[model samples]
Target chain A: MIIDVHVHTRLGPDPHGFAYLLDQAAELDVTLCVNSLSPKDGTGMPESPTEDEIRRCNDWTAELAAAHPERIIPMWYLNPAHEDFACRELEERLAAHAGLQGVKLWVAVRCNDPRLDPIMRLCAEHKLPVLQHTWFKVTGNLPGESTPMDLRELALRHPDVSFFWGHCGGDYEYGAKCARGLPNVYMDLGGGEAMNGYVDLLVEHETADHIVFGSDAPGRSLISQLAKVYGADLSDEEREKILHRNAQALFDQQKPANGAAS
Target chain B: MIDANAYLGNWPFRKLRYTTHIALLDKMDALGIEKAVVSSLENVFYKDQLAGNRRLHSEVHPHADRLLPAFTINPTFPGWEEDLDVCVQEFGMRVIRLHPNYHQYGLDSAAGSAVLDAARAHNFVVILATGLEDTRHHHPLVKVPDVPAEQVAAAVSAYADVQFLVAAANFSGVSAVWTEAAHTANVHFEISRVQGPVGDIEKLCGTVGADRVLLGTNLPLHVPEAATLAIEHAKITAAERRMIVQENATRLFGLG
Candidate 1:
C-alpha cells in the first residue's frame, strides 16, 4: 500500500483548492494521503489555523477516506500555538473519525515554544505519531521554521512521542547526522536534489527504520519524488521499509481501522 | 559527452565512500559521460587551490584524452595571475573555475577583474560557481553564500570578450538573467542545478535557445545520472538535446 505522508490541501489559502488535489491523488494511485492545511498569508507570529477551519479540513479528509475506505487515511492537523484548541480538535477528530491515525504540525513556530508541550503530551497520550515540518536552520526558508536542532531537542524532551521530521533536513548529510542518536526522530525524504548514494549514508550512518517516504506534492510532482527513491541504489527490503512499511508501523500503533497492514 | 562542470576529488560531506579515479571513471562511463572537465574539491575549499589543482592536473593530464582539466582559481588570493598563467601555459588548462563566495571575494572585485583579464588573454573559458547546495543546509557555522545572479550578470557584462558559464543558477534566475542579457552572447547556463519536470528544459531552451545551455552535474553532491537522464530525455528535438549535452560544452571548452 503506497502512502504519501506529506500533501497540502486548499482548505487553506492554496490557489488549487481541495477538489483538484483529490483528483490528482486518485490518479497517482495514492492509497492513503495525509493532508495538511496551511495558514493564510500575513498571519504573522504564531500563525494559527482557525478552529472552525481545522474542523472543516479534517472533516473533508475524513469524508474522502470514508467514501473510499481502502484509499484514504485522514491525519488531524494541529496548531500547537492554539494549545487548548489543538487538544480539543485532536480529541474531537479522533472521536469523530475512527480512521484518523495521526496528527500533522507545520513546526514553523519556535521549537522550544511552551505552547507545543501540551499538544505533544496529548499526542503521546493518544499514541499518535506527529509529522512535523522540519529542516536545518540553515536551509529553512522561513525565519522561524523549526530546524533539525530544534526538532532534535524536542525529540529528546518527548522521547515517547514519535516525530517524523520532514525534508531529511533539506540537506541530506547534516540532517542525517543531526537525527543520528535520537531514536524517536525519523526523517522524511521529501524535497531537494535526489542525491545519488544517499541510501548508503542512511544505512551506514542512520537507522534504516527511522527513514520514511513523503513527497511534498503539489509543490513537487509525485513522479519526480518517486523517481528519486526508485533511482537510488537500495535493496528491495530497505526500499520496502522506506516506501511504506515504516509509515505503516508508525500508524499501526494508532490502530486506525483501515490503517492495519494488508 | 563533455561535462563542463565535473569534479574528480572528494566532497567532505559525500555519502559514498571515496572511490579511486578508475572507479569514478567506470561510473561516469556507465552514465555515458565520455569526456568530463574535472576540478578538485580541495581547490574549492582549501586556502591553497593551486596545490590541489596541481595534484588534479597531474592525475588527469596523463589521460587528457577523456579527462580534461579545469584549474580552480581563488581570485581573492594574492598572486592569482601567476597561478592562472601556470594553470593555462604550464598545465595546458582550458577552463578556469571561480569560487567567489568560498574564497571570500566578490565576483565583481578588482581581483576578479584581473582573473577575468588573464582568462581572456589565455582564451580560457570561465565557469562561475553559484553554490553547491541550498545555503541553509550548510554546516551551522560554515556559510557558503550563493554567487548572486546580479554579480554574475555584472561580471558577464563587464567581460564581454571572455566566455562566461554560470553553474547552479535556479530556474527563475536563469530566465531573469537571459531576459536582460539575452544579447550577451558570451553567457551560458549549465543545466544540472536548474531543475523542474522533463519538459521544463524545453521551455527554458525555447526562451534562451539551445546554444546558451550546457550540461553540468554537481557530481559527488548530486547524482550525475539524474542530470544525464534529464538531458537524455528532454522533450526538445534530438539536435537540441545533443547541443545541450555534448556539442555546446565540446565547442566551449575545445574538448574533442
Candidate 2:
C-alpha cells in the first residue's frame, strides 16, 4: 500500500525514464504513484508553462494513468498564474478523469503569491491537497520559486487545505524548522539530496502526522529517495503513517461529490 | 557491500546524528554493508587535518573489522608528508581522501602532485570527495563548490597509476571525468553522487564499464540504504549489480 506521492512522467509521449520507474514501483510493492508531468530530456518544468502546455501535459499524465489503470493516479499540474484557466481546467480535468487526486505546483509561481489564492480556494472547495515544489537553494533560485518560509506563510493562510511541501525544502533542517507548527502542511521526503538527519528533524518538529512518502522519480533515484523514509530511524507506526496512511488520508479528502462541475 | 565513502565525527553546518564509528557500523550492519571506507568529517573543516586523521584512526581502529579509516590530507599545509606517514606507519590507514575545494588548492597544484606521489609511493587508494552536500544548500558560511570534473579528469589522465575514487560527483562527472572516451580504468566514481532520471546502473555500466563504478553511501552525512537500494533496484545484471554493490569497491580497496 506504499504510495509515492511525488513522481513525474515525461511531458508528451514518455520516451525516457518512465518504464523503469513503473517497474521499480511494482517490484517494491508500491500500490500507486501520484504522478505529475515533466520533460523527456531530463530537464525540469518550465518557469511559466502556457495554458495549452499545462493542458497537454495533464492530458499525457491522464493517459499514462489510464493505460496503467489502478497503478497510477494523475495529479493535475496547474500554474497558478493561469488562475482563471486553472479553476476552469481543474474542474474540466476532474470531470474527465475520476482518479485525478491532487494539484501539483512547480516553480512557475511562488506558493505564497496572491495568484495562488484562487487555486487554493478551488482546492479548499474540492478538499484537494496541493504538492508544492520547494527548495531553499544557496544558488539563486528561479524567479517565481517558493522557499520553505514562503510555503509556511501559504500554509498559515490556507489552514483547511493540506499542502505537501515537496523536497522538504533542500536544507530540510532549516525547512522543517520553518514548517514547524503548521499542522496542515505535510513534508514530502522526495528530495534526491539524500542527506541524513532531516527526517528526524521532521519527526521532532512536524511529527509523523505531517510526513508522507515521495521519490521525486526519474530525475532522482526512486530507491534512493524511497530509502529516505525506509532508512530513517522511525517506529512502525510512524513509518506506516509516512509510507501510506498520511497520503491516503489526503487522497481520501479529494473526493468531490457534486459530479465535478465548476 | 563496501561503502567506499562515509564519514565519522561532527559537521559544523548541521547537527549530525549517528556519526560515531559504532553508529556507522550499526547502520552499515542494518543496511547489509560489510565494510565502509570512512574519512573524518571534521578533517574537512579543521586546519590541522592530521588531528582529524588521528581522531578517525582512534575512532575506527577498535572497529577495524567493519570500519576502514582513511586519512584526510590537506596538501596545502606544511608537514603533510609527516602527517601522511604517521597515519600510514602508525595508524595503519591505507586510504587517502583529498578535499581540494574545501582546502582551496587546485587539483593541479604542486601539493596535489606531491600527494599523488605519496599515494603512488604508499600504494594507497586516493578519494576525491568534492561534493559533500549540494552546494546550493550549504551553510551560509560554507558555500564550497565541487572540483570540476574536467580538472579531475586531467589529473586522472596525468596519474594513470594512482587508483582514484571520485566521491560524491554527479552524472555529468561520469560523462566528462571518466567516460567511454577516456577508456580509463585507474579511477572509479562513487555511486552516492551519480544520480539522474532513468537510473539503471546498466546505463552507467553500459557507458563506463562495470569495473569503474564503486558503491559509496556517504554515510552519517547520508543514509546507507539509499546507496544499497539503488544497486538492488537497478536494471543491471546480477554480475553488474555485484560489481556495483561490492565487487568493484572490494577490489579497489583490496577488501577481499
Give the range where candidate 2 chain A is weakest over 10 consecutive residues by summed lDDT: A253-262
DockQ of every predicted complex? 0.24, 0.72
TM-score of each predicted structure versus truth: 0.81, 0.94
Sliding window of 10 residues with minimal summed lDDT for model 1 chain B: B12-21
Candidate with maximal TM-score: 2
Query: Tens digit of lDDT per residue, candidate 1, span A91-164?
Result: 88777766646777775466657778998898898777887777655644575577677778788889999987
lDDT of 2 by residue, A52-129 (tens): 778777887788877886678777889899879998988897777766477889888888899898888888887778
Best by the lDDT measure: 2
lDDT of 1 at B102: 83
Each candidate: what lDDT? 0.71, 0.80
The pairs that clash in candidate 1 are A31-A71, A138-B136, A139-B136
